[model samples]
Target: MPAILLLIVSGFYVGNTVLAEYVEKEAVKVPLEAYLKGHETGKPEYMQKAFHTDGKLMFIRDGNYTTIEFKDYIGRMNGQPAKDEANRKRYIESVDISGNAAVGKIVLDYPNARFVDYMSLLKIDGEWKIVNKTFNVEPKNSSD
Candidate 1:
């Protein structure tokens, strides 16, 4: 009886682990994918797909807190990839999810600047979408 109980417990543990991984992946995948495509292609449709309409980008500029609404931010994109796209690097560093909400950190390294982005996301109607984004951008030097 004890052996049988142990086997059942082990099976439950394995199943739980698998389910947790699935939840985490599903929670993080869509937003990151959209974010990557939008930045790489410089398209607003991809950005709109990833973010909520009211999402805002928050950052500090010249010692003042500044915000950019999603529409304006999307407008800043010129629908053209950066000239040095070959030298750019983008990565999703980490994501943490709880129930229907999540947070993610991403890094974008370009020839001219490096950006660290923090995204707040929620699962709305069975889909995960970014509701807010805040980032820090630093001008890059020729070396390092």
Candidate 2:
């Protein structure tokens, strides 16, 4: 029984190494770039990975800074309904790319929520990950 267990463990290790080596390069970056680009073009599906599964969002308003889970951010965004094509026009005005790191300035222009968002991103072990985010809605009398 011990021998059988040892063999199984060794086999699993070998298989894992082979699979890791066989994967193509730029494979992961494609999905990440696509997701960021989607925000520029307003593809909801692409917005999915912009946050980690257990990601958090931090922002400030009215002299207060608050942090919330990714799901809450998604829920708030989704809760507000918009007309056709309105959803896709939100653009990332600029994406500052530095090797594997990037920062995107996202401008969301909804009827009730017109804000400029800054996303601080990192290449966590080759995966594009959002580390910190800060944004504020354009207030009345403020130039967009």
- Best-fitting candidate, measured by lDDT? 1
Where's the lowest-lDDT run of ten residues in candidate 2? 22-31
TM-score of each: 0.90, 0.55
Write one digit per residue (lDDT tens) for candidate 2, span 1-144.
Answer: 999999999999999976864442233344446545654544455556666656677778677988988666556444233454454346557666656566777676764557787777776676776666678886544343
Q: Which RMSD does model 1 reach against the true structure?
A: 1.7
Q: Go through the candidates in order and give each one's C-alpha lDDT.
A: 0.89, 0.62
What's the residue-level lDDT of 75 in candidate 2?
A: 60
Give the C-alpha miss distance for residue 124 in model 2, angstroms: 2.9
Candidate 2: where are CA atoms >4 Å away?
1-45, 76-88, 141-144
Clashes by residue pair, model 1: none
The residue pairs that clash in candidate 2, if any, are none
Give a tens-digit lDDT track for model 1, residues 1-144.
999999999999999998987877766778877988899999888998999988999999999999999889888888888888889999898888888889999999988889999999998988899999999999978787
